[model samples]
Target chain A: MRIKGYVFTLFFVLGVIQDSVDGRPLLLSLSRPHPDSAADFARWLVSQNSWGVLNTIASDLGGAPFGNVVSYSDGLPNKGSGIPYFYLTTLDPTASNALKDQRSSFTISEYPIGTCGKTDPENPTCAKITLTGKLKLLDGNSDEVEYARTALFSKHPEMKDWPKGHNFQIFKLEIEDIFMINWFGGPKPLTVKEYLHIEMNKVAFVV
Target chain B: MRIKGYVFTLFFVLGVIQDSVDGRPLLLSLSRPHPDSAADFARWLVSQNSWGVLNTIASDLGGAPFGNVVSYSDGLPNKGSGIPYFYLTTLDPTASNALKDQRSSFTISEYPIGTCGKTDPENPTCAKITLTGKLKLLDGNSDEVEYARTALFSKHPEMKDWPKGHNFQIFKLEIEDIFMINWFGGPKPLTVKEYLHIEMNKVAFVV
Candidate 1:
């Protein structure tokens, strides 16, 4: 009986300490970064989320903003680059749209990360980010493509086995503007340079 | 010892039967709808999800496609209207942008619903839907407003208590096009009429 009790206690402690859902590696914890820390919060949002809606200008739809659900990664676990990379094929409208007009935005929510708790997904405190920029296709031969593939495949392991005939190419968003709402007030002012250059290791997230 | 074993088995079976994570109500089971049942699948997707990325054309950002994370409800619990209604404020760019250009698209994924299992979010089988149409703000006095408010507040109770100073108004997507991908093939052939008119009760969901 004592041994069983010890095992259950250990499991409970581990669950509380880690507290990460969906098997995602923990960099950000149950409690998020301070909303005032705009750059840190923005970077943490991008780093922690593996997928978001990638929006693009659909020429066929009379220039309406077309949003598609997509999987993306900033970098390998814990070592996020703050630049979201995608594995896309021209067969999809988003990639085709990007080819015609690179203007795009990727939106991620804290709700799916399961840290939003009881707060509504739309609640400002739940944390949502939109990275607006050019969705550029990387040259297949470039060194960055290798990094991107490693980053994407590491997070979404099944991507490595995705059908090759679809001719998936690597794409990265060159973030020019950041719109993030993490608290009661409107968007926190964050510059692209500040978002990209923040030393992620120095951010000191409470785990 | 016999009673303890029975209790453990009961817990294990209950976990498998109702495998819903994140405290979301289980309407669609772990095994999702057939991709061939396009209307059923689409309605299931919308009814099962509480929030999604609402895309709008940002006139200020040189007509870039801007996607924002927002909470939305189609109707109440199992009684879904299929027309996604949102509680938005003009202070937000999405609402303001819609006032300028009603053209918009809302994207939702099966991933957040927790039914996709290990399938990569971007995987065709994981299921995603984008409803493109005009985002029209409902007349505050209309009977639909009552339905919309009830729908929105029931799914997202926090929305009712949001700051009245923000002037949150009810808006809904007048869906014109349905773009859904649920399997290996590209988007399923679904029309606005088919999606909205589908008798959700007739199409059986295995729960």
Candidate 2:
């Protein structure tokens, strides 16, 4: 019970930070980068559990987004937990259909990084992030898939139960482009690096 | 010479296969996302010095589109090869200025996913992917910055040379929104299960 409270507290503080940052007027950082901050988010990711949704956008097919739950095996021998990758096997047909169409992009969003519940029903944990990239069906035999799966299983052993069948094939998500909304609220967009790594995990203070 | 030519030819053929599966028509393979016709491309990626380029969009302070080069670190602890992570660093004041001015977005074309030519234009390999996402200064201790760096660097040893400075903070191209262009060319996309415990060192026939 106490652990739950602590988790709740962490989320609350996180909200405050996001709101404060988003509330401020927008400013560019790189125009030179602050390597320190980038590293911050990455480390945080290394420290926690990675659960998120894998999404793809085939606007040509439909305007609605395609989403799925994914569990990551983050502890690959060489990759950082901060840069965790996942192996997904969904029975949903949306993914398979997308591949057949040979579309141009897919959007992946992280379920709100922190205490993912409703503070604002309309935008609750909509700290949703979308990554745009060219989707490629990896050759079932290549080492990439093996690496991807190994990376995923290292973190999540439960994934071994993944469904398999006649039409079953595995595809990988190669990130191409990215966008992130404020962890706070409004249009305080963020960079993908900020949310994915350690920042999301360590995001203890909000507003 | 023959080896390099073999590598280059292999690269183009892979590109075509990548285009067919990702850029062409959409195929649905959720639950079991087995992307079709993406095999050749994956093999090609492995064969080509283990790094490739992803042409993507970066949103500038003004909300305009710009191109940015994405350096892929396919080789993990052995960074010279293996499924590398794409990277980009911002040390230019102009980039910081632009980010400070506008919260931007970047679109990435995942083709040759490796280090781009230097932004300065003098270096032959100096490719610059566009920049997006507003940049911010690290807090005094900059817990965030530290976190991100370790996550990425621990995996990509070459990351040690990544741009770093006192006031300068380095960050990565975290993708948010993405799409792909596909047309079946060589190998197909990998299946979900094979992703675990896999090795990615295969080369498909080149065009």
Candidate 3:
């Protein structure tokens, strides 16, 4: 128990320190850049005004992919790539049914509306970048619970009136995967390889 | 094989017809909307912007949810109810690696930039949405490959010479499960039930 307590304390400290990095994933499955590069990516995200799509694996029903959309709040840690945080409220029977059947994955994609010919509104091309993570529904306020909520709302003020109940569940996603799309071409398609090495270079993600 | 095709085609036809009403699952998951709700939802998606997050579950893979930001050019067979229908290119090693390890769940969420608050240059709240589906990679069209080159420029224009080889590797997501975010409040969070009800009442999606 003592060792556990010590470990808990260490984790707590690490979580707080992690705040310094914002909500960016502490451990990404890919390459990590220098602190400067990390900072560059974070600043770019805010400046770009990019929205995030998060992907997670739901619990299950036979074998199929279940997914949901939730908005991401990038301001929590404030450093940019800090922690990828967001808030979502659902009352749909379909979502509830899916949730009941299995956990869901969220894909948060950010894009530059103007740059990708999305400026006209009549015909828009959106450039996208995605983050991959795992989400767990939270019970009540505990250590991680509070952190998640605080981090979420700090960035998205619109979520201020959402209720707190078993109905208004909170999901926590452990960051895992990250990808960005090079969508400069309007309808013309690009390969996954070109996507990574070419168009995506502008986004300065944690590559 | 012919008989099996016939049966599958029958199911396909029935599903296409019942899209909006029943939310039928099909090979191209984001193929279309339920007949009844097709027009309304299509209008909504256009008004709300077709660019949103799609949350999906790889029911086969422990209900893993995946979210991808996709470009939607509906007017296809069944393109309403906001079912995703498009192409995506991902070269991220992590994403490819993840696919090798497991199937994925995906989701896409959409939010109006200024719906909740004011969106200005300094204070920007980006509009969002997603396409959640099973993922796989593919190459770009031979004729249009050059323009699709990301090596030219991260932005829309080109910088220098184009890269060689198959421009795109490929990442195609056949969607099965999905949900869109209905965020109109602050921190309190809206329940999916309420959101879905609003969507249903506002429009008729059932075939």
Which candidate has the highest DockQ of all?
A: 1
Put down candidate 1 lDDT per residue, B30-57, tens digits, no spaces. 2345577788779878987888999999
Pull out the clashing pairs in model 1: none
Fraction of true interface contacts that also occur in model 2: 0.00
lDDT of 1 by residue, A101-127 (tens): 999999999888877776788999999
lDDT of each residue in A1-207, candidate 2, tens digit only: 798766644433442222111122222211111222333423332323244334443233232233333344344422343343544333333355446432323222222222222222112122333344444566778876677677666544545544444233445544444443323322233455543443333333222
Best by TM-score: 1
**Model 1 chain B lowest lDDT segment of ten:** B8-17
How high is each candidate's TM-score?
0.87, 0.32, 0.45
lDDT of 1 at A127: 95
RMSD list, candidates in order:
9.0, 21.5, 16.2
Please rank every candidate by lDDT, starting with the best: 1, 3, 2
| Top lDDT prediction, candidate number | 1
DockQ of every predicted complex: 0.52, 0.01, 0.19
Residue B23 local lDDT, model 1: 47
True contacts kept of each: 0.73, 0.00, 0.43
Candidate 1 residue runs with Cα over 4 Å from true position: A1-17, A23-31, A202-207, B1-19, B23-31, B201-207
> What is candidate 2's CA lDDT for residue B132?
23
TM-score of model 2 (CA atoms): 0.32
Give the residue spans of candidate 2 off by over 4 A: A1-39, A42-49, A57-64, A72-91, A101-127, A166-168, A182-207, B1-207
Per-residue accuracy of model 3 over B1-207 as CA lDDT, tens digit each: 798766643433442121111111222222122222323323343333334443333334343554445443322223332322333322433244335543543333223322223331111122222233354443466422332233112221222232333232323344443233332232222232332332322332225
Candidate 2 positional error at A145, Å? 1.9
